[model samples]
Target: MDKVLLKYAEYNEPHESCTNTDIVDILNKKHSAMKPAASGSSEDTEMMGD
Candidate 1:
């Protein structure tokens, strides 16, 4: 999870309106949606080798 999300979850811990699980679920969905494309350029792969 991201630091901002983690902080938000922590802040919500004392509130009755939101739960940690809810925050986690939202974070998961956000992360999946923000995932990078599977295909990488040749330059990207070459940099990985170094």
Candidate 2:
């Protein structure tokens, strides 16, 4: 889930010493933490490293 966390960080930078659980908690609180990429989207490959 590093990709997800990294993407999340782009929108909101977390504490320097935060752990993975901390990052997930931050996302959980937001509710809309992530959404699936659109079809035929190049961004999906670029950002997701597909």
Candidate 3:
């Protein structure tokens, strides 16, 4: 994330101007679209027959 921002900064692009809320919104959207790991919790472990 820092590297991406740095590149944007070097290029004088507006992409690097995003605030914390913007980054959190992006991350939250991405996280919601992905499944949790198999070993993520006791419930998941039971479901996996672990």
Q: Each model's C-alpha lDDT?
A: 0.73, 0.68, 0.71
1-50 per-residue lDDT for model 1 (tens digits): 69777765765456556689999999998877666543346558989999
- Comparing candidate 1 with candidate 2, which one achieves the higher lDDT? 1
When summed lDDT is taken over every stretch of 10 residues in candidate 2, the lowest stretch is 31-40
Which parts of model 1 are misplaced by more than 4 Å? 1-16, 36-50
User: lDDT per residue, candidate 3, 17-38, as tens digits?
Assistant: 6899999999998787654642
Candidate closer to the true structure by TM-score (higher is better), 1 or 2: 1
In candidate 1, position 35 carries an lDDT of 62
Report the lDDT tens digits of candidate 2 across residue range 1-29: 99877775755555678889999998886
Prediction-by-prediction clash tally? 0, 0, 0
Q: Candidates sorted by lDDT, descending order?
A: 1, 3, 2
lDDT score of model 2? Answer: 0.68
Clashing pairs in 1: none
